[model samples]
Target: MFNRYEADETYGLHVDNAIRRVTGSSVTVRADLSATLFLSDPEGYDGGELQIEDSFGAQRAGFELPPGVEAVNLKDRPPLPRAVLEPHQSIVFQGMMGEAPRWEDLHWLQRQTELPILVKGIQHPADALRVAEMGLDGVVVSNHGGRGLDCLPSAIEVLPRIRAAVGEDFPLLLDGGIERGTDVYKALALGADAVMVGRPQIWALAVAGALGVAHLLRVLREELEVTMALAGTPTIADITAEALFSGP
Candidate 1:
């Protein structure tokens, strides 16, 4: 529920049949593997929707992987196709909702859905306060794993300021650099309601499949338990600044 990524039916909302015209065909974007729904024919219809799983954070328009996207893996998997562009040469993804998420876009989205919406890639305290002003559900503090820009600070480094900016009641979560359970503990102490992790799960999947993932979780749990015991925090609630050896 708290991961950086989210998907809701790939198609979550619906149009009132009263406003729905059979002639008003929805313009759909069928990406290679994923399908993101867009308001396609808003002029012809009264109500429509859109959803971006990882909902923000980019210096440019669109998102894409390095490569191997167009590659075909078969019964006998093939070698990852050779990189056509230089390592830094980015390839644009065509089917993605064009353009990075904008302030106006979030405001417009508010007009469309009553469903809770949270924006990711927010590291600035001002931005976090802006999200609250916009009535967004929450924010995932991230630098998009630091893959987007070299100048962005790690999520943890900026978290305390964001927390202070938003105040305690806001639902603030942190993402990026969550490798160990101690990472999780410190993140909470720093004022994150929760944390999200990515690379480790992928590494587990590569190394030993589902079993590996389960083992990795167990290890993290044990580490967190050890950390809590050593700090004398019996429960997650007891984990506060006192538990952190160094101030956040």
Candidate 2:
């Protein structure tokens, strides 16, 4: 889940409620893992630190990034415009891991049997390669939906480079500028394992709450299926780079 506001304010309250509803033991089928991706630097604003609670109701990780120059480490890419967080500024943690061992436990679990964790908002293929080498499950090619930086390459345009950096079988998720089934198809053909829908999903929720969101997902799914059929692809695996062409 993404939190754009400070953690001690109204936004934090809302997040708590959402978590209760989604992962409370009484809800049945508790969530095995949860994470928060920071969209802003800790010093950029104030009070938006990420606080997590474990299954035992203990605050597991309450973290905030360092501010200013301290947050900008020498990454693989040449210097580029980017928001820098303070040390301990980024909050990343796993919420839960089921009994018995699994891949979910491999990355985040050693600390407490947690699930794998990853940080997104990456652009450079070298950066993606570095994260994959750290044993992360994958990286999502995104620009925070164009909200972070202007004139950034669309996620689609950078996906193949990231895929090559990470390797053939590594998972790569994409986010940004996806508005139709063709967009989804284009992303898949370009090597994205999955795509995330943001603004459109919010618009649906605003228009009709949960039911509206469900309807939106259904429509998108049907559209994607239809697009797949028309493209002579029978299943998700059948989608390949050959199925797409650069825009005219």
Candidate 3:
């Protein structure tokens, strides 16, 4: 598969290669599926449209690539307006639309811009170290928010190891099972720079819309403040490793 990173960078209609170089030397990957992840916000840039033609392949029985999908040459068929399609409807057509981007890719990405890049989906300390070694802006020690696989260790369980790997100053974010202020405190005590709450925010949004979300965030902040006060911690820096303990 190919990636277009810059604002003007574009990939013409083309097929993917079977093998890809994972490292700078010679390590390669065999790919069976093609995916795309739009890293930038939609409004952040312009003219980067992921256009797939009908001739390339059949996406579904009913929703075939598009009429006359056999045109190999991109010049034969110009890209259609992707905005015309609804947001959710494109999911089926774009199967597995992101990738486990490699270290080399991240390194190259760092060279491309000055903006900080935070790699997500880090579950191992080794991987976290690799991220830090790459000089990335930050990392999120997560299990894809527990959406990837079954029987994996929780994010909280691996937080300290990753913290140890990257050291104290590295910005490390943790995601998964963070439901309340106490949970946030626990994550911070274990060495996370911050905690990301997912389902809780969604639940709040579903129950009370924007106001509910705002109130939920306020309540979470208040709860953490109260938790800190009760724990004899007056500041964020005071909630160190000493604030936590292993339990039976």
Best by lDDT: 3
lDDT (Cα, tens digit) per residue for candidate 1, span 211-231: 999998898889989988988
Q: What does the lDDT come to for candidate 3? A: 0.76
Q: Worst lDDT window (10 residues) for model 1?
A: 14-23
Better of 1 and 2 by lDDT: 1
User: What local lDDT does model 3 show for residue 9?
Assistant: 63
Per-residue lDDT tens digits for candidate 3, residues 142-183, read: 887555687789988988888988888999988888888999
Write model 2 residue lDDT over 127-234, tens digit each, in one string: 788777767777889988777678898888899888888888888899998878888988998899999998888999999999998998888889999999999999
Estimated TM-score for each candidate:
0.59, 0.55, 0.60
- Each candidate: RMSD: 19.6, 18.9, 17.9
Which structure is stronger by lDDT: 2 or 3? 3
Candidates' C-alpha lDDT: 0.74, 0.70, 0.76
Candidate 2 wrong stretches, greater than 4 Å: 1-113
1 or 3, greater by TM-score: 3
**Per-residue error (Å), model 1, residue 167:** 0.9
Candidate 3, residue 35: how far the Cα is off, in Å: 31
Clashes of each: 0, 11, 3
